[model samples]
Target chain A: MESLVLKDISITLGQNLVFDKLSLEFNKKVNTSIIGPGGSGKTTICKILNGDLKYNGSILINGIEIGESNNYLLEKYVGVVLNNSYNKNSLVIDELFAGLDTCNLDYEEEEKRVKKVVKYFKLQDILEKRISSFTIQKKYYIKIIKELIRGCAYIVLDDIFINMDLKEVKRIISYCKQENITIINITSEMEYVLETDNLVVLYNKNVAMVGSTIECLKEEKLLRRLGFNLPFLVDLSIQLGYYGLINKVIIDDRKMIDAIWK
Target chain B: MEIILQDIVCNSTKADKCLNKVNYTFKENSINFCSGLSGRLLRDLLTLKKQRESGYIFVNPNGRLSDIGYVGNNPLKEFTCKTVAEQMLYFKDNYHLKYNNVQEKIKSALLMVGLDESYLSRVITSLSTSELKKVSLACVLFYNPQVLIVDYFEKGLNYKDIEYFKKLFKKLKIKYNRNIIICSDNISNYLDILDEYVIFNNGVLEVKGTNKELYNNVIYKYIEEPHIIKFINLVRKKKGVELDNYIDIKELIKAIYRDVENK
Candidate 1:
């Protein structure tokens, strides 16, 4: 699999070392979550990926150099979906569909594509509603649709799920999974990281742990020492594993429930 | 400080009345929350945007209007100063306090929000969203306000930042006897930290009780519960595995272990 890879990246922001020889890789199609506490350089990493911040290392997406790619073209493949404020004045549907080509397809074809993207996020019911009128929870979903329409494969969301509860975010996870979109959720919330395929934990400006979500969370004491608690399901699954009720730490609720049933 | 809103009738431009004969008495030195209400209604309560039809909001008798501090909902817009230290001094001036300890208070305020003295010199516009929020919180707490209102206070904050705020607010209530009232739709995030929840239904005071008291109430019916709570409820409903008194992840894990052990 072609992967988004960072090689020996280092960054210093105004005397603070944000990253020090930090290296990580993400497959192009798998969901990854980067989580850490405040001042842990989650946003800084996002800026570097989004080409807003300069760093002294190599960032390659499927072996294409990130620094050399044109801004407009670079964004299409490795775009970001920032947590746009709910009170933004621009109409969202118009904004999402603004930059596409108009050379060949007629209005109906474009509208059909828009409708498909809208249906992907289940926004068919409220596609015409004003962006300002949406509840705060739904606003992030709109950004996801916008990013998909903008053709961003490696989507970086730093704080989009800050206000979203776990249940709401899980639905978004399913959507991303079905679309095979590579999501890098950069935040301190364990909710997203627990649901994602890969987990990257940051602490003291370095990668503390990197593994599959279930495996990394199995470092329960280490995570707790870093001032974070595991997700309820992960913790429970670990405890059940200790009791020999389950053979391994399972991330799925249905699997764990069925295991317990057996 | 205590806030008593009695028989309050508030009308929206589109609707006849959003708040209908609502009544609530927010007590002193408590961590209070109001959920299931529009952010507009909650903002109006915290800000007093419009006049009530035939009711009154009674603040503590000796309370100066300046003592009531609001932290969010365009904190920068309400700010008059361009820098951090000056913001605290402005609050000092507005409160008509003696200027002798203004700098000291500014330092203490910044420290309260986990910012150091160096942050006082930084330009407000250069601060991050989390930093701005902490700065706003510091400015409000700098005045030693008896009653503090946090409107969607956890906005733009990470989980650890929220924990710091929870600890600080609890300290403020216990040590200084200050009232920390949060008006947020994200109730589950603050569920563990809140001492009491004041739920609103159709702008009326639907229920008011401690966290345990309000947990099983129908008010949580509308909004989603926190994941652990929902998980426990689901397990109980589906597998007949009833866990007892889960406040957080650790407790829930223990409860599950005990259940599985007994089996």
Candidate 2:
């Protein structure tokens, strides 16, 4: 079943028409990353998904058209972490669970969930610390993945990788995959996006490309024109193929190393 | 223009020192990149401060001269000028530098950083991520300091903008003899432009050397071992081609094509 569906979506911000007839469907248990340039409406799409921004076209969740009736319902299902920094003074890590007390989930049950995610993110050392003292990047580290682990049906992250290290990014991606959380990560970094199950390329506020990872990588000219960096592994694989060193282009470094050794 | 740090240590509010007696000297009139993991305290060491420590940072140029600049991550917060033009002029007026035309200077700075001239009149709050970054860079460029300390150099720039900024840095160094100290987690992105690198791990200065030497060094085995470097190494081993240190894909392609042509 499709977890989220955006059909012929169009968004206009101020004098700019950000998205033009863009359409895409995200399936449950599949991690999807949206790749685009800086101002290519990737954030607009995420806003539409989170119901923060209104669009002209249709967005359906579980075959139910998204509108007033389902807006609040959708909030329970979708967890979002935007690109901007978050400032949460007078709040601590334990207080986060206390605030979620009104969400109807039992305190003990919520603690287990929070503890599980906190440990996963290696936040055990700073669990009692105030949110105000944490760095902008650390605030994101706790907020983004923790909310998703607390039973949000869909996860949406925008440019979270910009402030993150490679190990943290890899851990977050791996956690999203292990949890079977339907993730829609929007990033300008192609290397980070290539780790996703599917890729959506937005150019000039339109859906220029959409397909598997390799399919998007194969369209090097289009990717270049969109100002997206090609993944180094993909470039290496292509170079090897160009030099007749390898017959098949492999994106996984381990697989490529195995092929070369063989 | 060389910035030499000897026994530099910065402590946070809780008495936890982010930088622990770190020491290194960045080459003059050249790009020096510092890369490490996020939350690894690289930025703190670069700026010589923690989260709470915000005031003036002293940039020692060689042994005899030193200059001070306001130290803050968000440049927009540091500016109090009412208009964009006023802001550029304010920096010039206070610094006592004369430009041919204030408007032209602002326009050139915006264009050099890949921003449209139409944004000059717009409020600073109205700018996009990339635009805001360009404006910050413009402020730095306008100051034309002997030494520039940049944090997250390519944070919000697209691929084209990254290339543009790379070329802009080279031009700035050549034309104006400006020295840049860029702090980022991704070093390969600026390998072509950088003359030296200073690796910071856990607030301690681990290694400082040329780009090639750092690449060959085993301490940075993971971060510096980019695929391009591996591919270049592979070509050198397989075909005995002496590739340049800054061997990007385009350069690799040209080298391969040349080899084929000669054969």
Candidate 2 structure quality by residue, lDDT tens digits, B52-145:
2332333444322112222233456656675566777777877777677777777876677677677666677545566667777776566566
The fraction of reference interface contacts (C-alpha pairs within 8 A across chains A and B) present in each candidate is 0.24, 0.33
Off by over 4 Å in 1: A84-86, A99-109, A165-168, A239-247, A252-262, B11-18, B38-49, B52-54, B73-82, B125-129, B155-160, B201-207, B239-242, B253-263
Most accurate candidate by lDDT? 1
Q: What lDDT would candidate 2 get against the real structure? A: 0.68
**Cα lDDT, model 1, residue B234:** 68
lDDT of 1 by residue, B129-218 (tens): 677789999988887778888877776666668888999999999999998888776676777777887776555676778877645746
iRMS per model, in Å, is 4.1, 4.7
User: Candidate 2 versus the native: TM-score?
Assistant: 0.83
Where is model 2 more than 4 Å wrong at Cα? A87-92, A95-102, A131-137, A258-262, B13-17, B36-100, B218-225, B229-247, B250-263
For candidate 1, the lDDT comes to 0.73
